[model samples]
Target: MEENTDINLSSGKVESPSGRDDGDKFNLQRKIFVGNISYRVKQHQLTKHFSQFGTVDYCYVVKDHLKKWSRGIAFVTFQDKKSMTRALQATDEELMLDGRLMRVAPAEESKRVSYSEGANWQTRLPPSLPTQTQDGDTCESDFHCSEQVTLPNVSHLELDACGECAIQRLYDDSLMLIFSFLSVKEHVRVERVCRRWRHLAQKSWNRQHKLQFRHMFKGFIKGLTDSILNSLLQRCGVYLRALDLSASPQLLSDLCADSIGANCPNLTELNVSGASVTDVSLRTIAQACPKLRGFIQERSFYVGDKGLTSLFQGCQSLEHVDVQNNAGIVGDCFHSLPTTVKYLNLDHCTKLSDLGLRKICLRCKHLTELYISHCKSVTDQSLINITQNLKRLKVLHMEGSYSQITSSGLKKIGQLIFLKELSLSQNSAVDDGVLVQCAVGCSNLTNFDISGCYKHVTDLGIQALTRCSDLSYLNISYLSHVSDSCVEALATSGKLQSLVARTCSGITDRGTSAEPEHLDTSRSSVTINMYNLSMPHLKADREIMLRPADSSSEEEEEKEEEGGGQSEPVSLCHQSVMAAGAEITSDNEWDVNELDGFECDDYLIGDDPLEEERWSLS
Candidate 1:
């Protein structure tokens, strides 16, 4: 019998005829044989091309035994037999290999001559069948075959079949949705990827409805001019609902304002705080944007009453306005404000007096919140007017305005049963009388601040505040008269979430502790006659330790020595009343050190003061 060359079709190698079972050889037939491959193609390149159909296990390109050059054939074995079947079915037409058409089919076995053993050598042929020439020599070319096969034309292939083929299949809307999550800076970086990605990123950026220029400081200094603002407004301003240009103060002028007014007609909210805007720019924006609802122009020195008048007269849909520190607004200009306004802030407006406030309360009946802190000219009459006219008021801030307001003003404030948040800090005349009135009527109160009113606030005031079942935030710092009794009263409220009582020397550790310990007075219980009749009866029974005298002050030491070395207890009298009387002369001069403890820093270090039954309201 003629020698039959046994070839391993999976590895493209020849083996000697042995007693191996036919089942082992049949299992190796799950590899697809690809032919007509170019000589430049490598094993990895072949595997990469075949991986698109299924997961390939191993791929090998057959080579000559002596010359070590490619034989223009390769075998690709898949992980499963199903992958081999799918690969054969998917490649119905000619497969492209490095710009050339190739043939793909099931691997088969054939006989061939092995060059390593000369004429006597017998081997297996690759996927293509070899033919013999008329010169009595065996060849590997298929030209001598009976049937002819033509190659495909390279120019007729699809253009997207080569580079980045996977990503090119995504639709335009899908691409836009993927790019919309990227920020402005990331969008700029993605534009350099390719022409298609750049087009999609640009389209998504142009459709943005909100833009904040707060972090573009360097760009504002170099490129944000009037022309740039005008160009930006002309491109995407029509779709913008919120625009924040507060950071670029130097670039915002009348020209930029005029461009925004002409282009952004659908804008509902605008922030130009700390910008160099004048009355003309304000009037232009107000006259152009009829749908304007919320405007913030804080710290703009050049915008006066005329601009405010124009804005209120033109924008009937206005609901919120913040013009803090605009000192040019006089009492007469408030008449132009519409009754549709609900929230108004005129903090630090020194020109506004009781007359202007009364006018606001009478005209804006729909107002629910008002902030007039540092308006020194406002007195008790303003609060009376607010309670009588603006029945819908809920939030009021009158801190730092105690020069004219007295305890009588709080009586009118208590009548507003709908009040939820009230801030009367730095008002020297607010005492327990005010708290008594508030507890009787203001049942809906949730937030109260009486910090700096050290004159007459005592434990009795906090005890009276327990009637407000919804009280959550309380600030009574700087009140020297507040003692452990006030803390005890607040602890029992069962709804306090935040409590600040710093600078109150009367609150001992026993009051702030969650679990109080019994005092150990058995060691130094001394009976002495109490000469100070002003001391409370309960304090006189407890053992008191006198503080040491100041050695740096010679007068204090001499006085203590003259009293036969007997130290006196420091008086617990109110510190604000003993001196020139606690008065806030300037808003900047307010002592921040006394109020810093009222923040959340202390709550992070020690136990929270309001940890039990604490709750917060919206």
Candidate 2:
């Protein structure tokens, strides 16, 4: 839930109610960090804007010391910590100052560098110098991880004239702030210190709402058991908000889901992609967390329409839902989706037809991001309906699905001016004229991937992409019609970062023929992967062969999508292999059994033979 931006401004500078002023102290503790202020905003204007919260003592806008350029950040100080607290209460609110929306948060303690009186350079050493093993480590350091750390012998120290303990004099909030900096292991140790310390440490644990299992265990998360999860959740209580198990493969099955549903009632975001959850688990989760906004149960073993329907009916406030690659979902499960949903992913739902999509467009009209990749049943009509209804759509990824979106549907897609990322990787109908319309229409386009559009999208369609000033990430791999000229034009765009041109036969044999050289890569940071090959027999899955280095062996990627309609290229590094049907040979017999895959660079040379008209052998 978003907080209200309504400011509680006061008339003028608030005088300290108790008549104690710390304006001369320059107390960094009682300060707030302000950001996104207009570059032209004066220091006094910032002070005036935040005067409603409390007494403003001083304000300073940060600048690049060398260039003297405004950093658009400011530090506002108050006479007391209460004023700082009042300002931080509106951390999520977009406070406008000088007609520009600004962000505010509690300022961290600042440490000044030793500098000369007039210069910014450090001319002298700082007040304190570091030596080895002076204080102890807070996190799981060497001594703590290797062996048990026994408490050291205590020595009495002098205190104030009064009988009060010196540490007890500090505010409880200050003590809790110190505890918040410690790691989870350190928190357990702090609890055994004393009664007061234990009480404060428990408060810190209860306030910790987000928990990622990967952070708790540095090694393989397979060691995570039900006992460990229940113990941690027992400490976090019902305040647990986000639970992520993406790193823990083969984690607790349905029982794990039941434990989470029973414990984490306040969960807002949950990812169980690595777990083996069933429809019963989803039903339990739906009944427990009604205010869930983002939920992901991708690549599940037993999840289907029955669980998804329960989720939509239970959590009406859901905004982001991803259930990709679950083949069990074959029915109209999208009709009950709430209007509040902004992002939806139904990729690899093979049986989903155009009717289910029509119902989605009619209900979730405010969708901004939609992913229906590898959903072959989705025809041109469903895509046209999406463009007509969802005007706020920004990121649409319908890669590798082989309904082949034609000009009528592509024309409707071009009208989506708000689109930023559009992935039409294997859609056969995205030809030269269709791409020209999209290049002219989507002015805000940044990421465009048309990797396997093949013979249809030539240099004419690719060159048209230069009109998109924001085009950054492009994948032109496997397009036989694309040439060096098209690649050169797009690289000069200055914004292109990742250009995946792995298997273009039209490219020259300059890089691959030599000892792994680059084609003018110094001009830009774009990773131009040009492993030019001519393997027409192989077929790649869009999601399977994307990040080539992720696969442990060749056999793992070849397991799925042999009978799919599209013949997409399987690209990963310099080598790729796609076995069609049961025709996949042994691991030793890839790419004619030579150097195999990316290693056989000599055999996989570019096929743009020198023509007499172009390079005449006179």
Candidate 3:
């Protein structure tokens, strides 16, 4: 058997190898010095591997001083002495690295002492360690190390106790606030952490008033059922104010409406446009949601006059009703419509006619905006009724309902001075007389559309509209008789912003080319689109030729002209227009030239071969 010996540096104590003093053993158990490590191993890799056994405070791989290459050795220090003890036990199992086994052991006292005396000893020592001089007094200088190397006084038990106290200091309300910032998915995920978090997450979800499950498309596997609605209502329906089930309305049934009516009593806005709801559901909503303000039941085919009557009778606070495209709705439904309603849209309700509109005008005096477009049954009598009553009307859309409306009705429509936007496109009977009446009466009109009125409208009608100086948007596309004179008149209005005159055969390049001069140059903003015009291609080519050229191209062209031999002579009018276009293209300067006749300078150039007979008149 080999003889064993033990040595202790602190207190100059010595003992047999088998009978080592506990105090000396504890003092030396601070750092584990590993040897025979792979040369390719880094400090962080060693630290990460050793951290699995215990909390490693610091790790260092020794390197060659000049070459900066790993020396196949490293040191790992731990915060507590118990962790060092566990790491020593764990090292008995071979640590494999790059198909090779590593060696680990407690550093020898001589090696530790040499390291303390090295030039980098000040940096290697832990920050929490206190240095002491030979006189037994703590010294502030980092160059010195204590005689005895010991672990920190903190243990695992003290760390656990401190963490628990920190958690206990937070109140329930503060904890809830911190949890509220997490997303709904995160809230559910963290519930598995402990019992307290699960309870708080459940409580927070219950208090949520606004619930939108539109993204959970799979959750509505079955149409919105009474059981599912009741389950949701039991949890959050009491406090719910806004519920959006707009997505997947096919899942909504009559029971879902009843569930909402019974549970969500404070509902203000309801949208069940494409649902399978019937007249029974509408009656239930009217009786249940007394405080309802806005209702949208577009395309709900089963809802007819009976449903409308029930809704109007129960929901007195209703302000907006949009029953668009509901063909079953007839004129008789407006008889029961609440007077409190201000905005009503009966668009595409083909069954509604003048009788229904008359009832609406007589009852709904607070109406400010009405859209009955595409209701072909509506005629001049409907518009006459609207103007007679709803004097507060600001927007009226009568598009596609021009079969029975003539200039006589349009003349009466001009009496509504509050009209700001008017659309009478596709009306064949609208002529210049109606426009004259509109200009004389409604001067505040901002947007006017008569795009498809191809019959009986000419420059006379456009000239009549010039009195409305505030017109910003004008659409007279497809009108065959509107010419450049109308465009010039519109440009001089000074406030025109957008003008759409597509397919108008009378508007030529010359007329549109001169139209810009009459615009409000002080504002410097004008947009004129002449799509599908007779000379669109020619106008595009002319616009390209009018683009300004650089100084090099200009000099080249001048030299070519100076050395001219058989080049064609350019017209004076065309040259002056090119110069004006170039100046405008280069500097954005507008030189508004009059449309008077131009002098061709034909006498100086000799007899011009390309000169037209019209030039002689100029």
Candidate 4:
């Protein structure tokens, strides 16, 4: 049987003016009855209203479950003696409600068999608390994960006390500024110090926070769930400034389509180096992080022309881009990039050509460093255009088979005046005269590469380079006309550190045959001496195998479809699989191979084959 416990809240015992008891008893601590509340009255509403005069310790609204009715009274506990005194002084005897004079006087504690379990008040439980199961066992719910991970046995009072202890130390302006530059991982460690430290870190994070996720992709990706990120941001009240998602292009689409963007409005720096992201992903980034300043990704991340256009138009604040090995990026794409971009790396971009380079030099005037190494299609016109337009251009790299460039083109490059490093290796047109012209035009040149400019390069070229007083590193390897005189001059150049002149037939103290000698007659002989002499780092070697401009082979036809032309004849140095100092086989093999005897000497070394009739030039 349940207790039918009731307190006479209305009729409290009062003493007469003479100080005699009126036979009715009242207990101030047990209850101060306040009446006429509906069952719908929530604890938060009651506490808010009652706590105005004094701090409220607890508020309980009694309700009957069977009939779903309010008990018409609630218990309000004051924090201290002063609070109780203030409450009495501020209120009257009656609380008028529902057109009746409700009671507001202290009442005696209920003494029926037991206290009534009448309060239907909802407990002020933390969000991370466990839920009761059917077997009476408490199991943690998803919401409980955060609580379980937090300090044990922590209560509201303890939180308040701990928070107070940390307030003075954290609110110090100097400490706040000190945490400003800390990385995201370091910030996490600070927050885990103690309950007070955690609260302090949270306050600091909320006020002003920036996350440096540099090289943290592995750990971030492991636990980077939508729920966790959203929860952390919302609770901590922070905006992410730098989000280094380098090499995480695969997550961009998923993160954007979800509410990640809406939650992280302050994102600025982004790095996505290797995840082959497409145009759609870049567009998504533009929409999500409107204030984004820098974005980094590999070429495979872009989808098509639309992707390039979207990034250019959307990320107006963008300044730097590092796109390596992206074959699809063409010359036309330069027009889309923001003018603010100062540093650009299009390294190993095979499809990019001088036309695009010309576009970049003209539009992006502030560009200082341009890296186009291993981009085989760059020509003299492109280099000339860059030198003329970009006055501030400092470093230019055109390494790998720039054979089409002539002395006149290099002379034009000297116009930059401030050009620091110039690389034009494996070009058939480069010779003593070209080197002389380069040395005269660009006196500030510190680094130079005229490698693989064989046959015509002589000691005269080294004399011309003497004018470049600042020349630091020079590569003149495979220039068969160079000898002890040029090497001695380079050795005394004072600024020269590296000088590559390996396999230059002209460098021999004793004269050798101009014609290449045979290594072995057998085609499959692995031990052939000629194989050892095959030059390394020579682009002409690969070019020789490429089908000639007029070849009718299927591979050539395919290359034409891909690159859109039958290009000029290419000079090739054989990659030797023979012994050192071995001679090369006869040029007759050229007729049988896929690429026939269309030679670089015909167009470059000798007089114009076009000047004479088809038979006369030979």
Best candidate, lDDT? 1
Worst 10 residues of 3 by lDDT: 137-146
TM-score of each: 0.57, 0.55, 0.55, 0.49
Tell me the spans in candidate 2 whose CA falls farther than 4 Å from its real position. 1-178, 189-199, 218-222, 401-411, 488-498, 509-618
TM-score, prediction 1: 0.57
Query: lDDT (0-100) at residue 174 of candidate 1?
Result: 57
**Model 3 agreement with the true structure over 458-500: per-residue lDDT tens digits:** 9999988889888998988778787889898887874778877
Clashing pairs in 1: none
Q: What is the lDDT of residue 229 in candidate 2?
A: 72
On residues 1-618, what C-alpha lDDT tens digit does candidate 1 reach at each position? 237665544455554444233464533456666666788999999898888777898998988866899877778888665676677666435277786677555654322111221122134232333333343323232112222222233222222222233443345555677777866556567776655677666676656788667666576456356776776677568888888777676766667788889889988898888777888888899888878889898888898888888888888888998999989887676798888899999988888878898889888999999999888778888889999998888999988846778888877788889999999887777889999898778889999998777778888987899999999989887777878887888778758877776556687777876232444447844332323332332232123344354433566578788987756644222111212343544432423344344544333222332331131211
lDDT of 2 by residue, 512-588 (tens): 33234534557744343345553443233344456665445555445445644434555432343333343433542
TM-score, candidate number 4: 0.49
lDDT of candidate 4 over 176-267, digit per residue (tens)? 45555566566667766444446546556754444333465575456344454455556332356665444334444444323435666666
Cand. 2 TM to true fold: 0.55
Candidate 3's TM-score: 0.55
Model 1, residue 27: C-alpha shift (Å): 50
Output the better candidate (3/4) by lDDT: 3
Error (Å) of candidate 2 at residue 251 is 3.1
List lDDT for all candidates, in order: 0.70, 0.69, 0.69, 0.58
lDDT of 4: 0.58
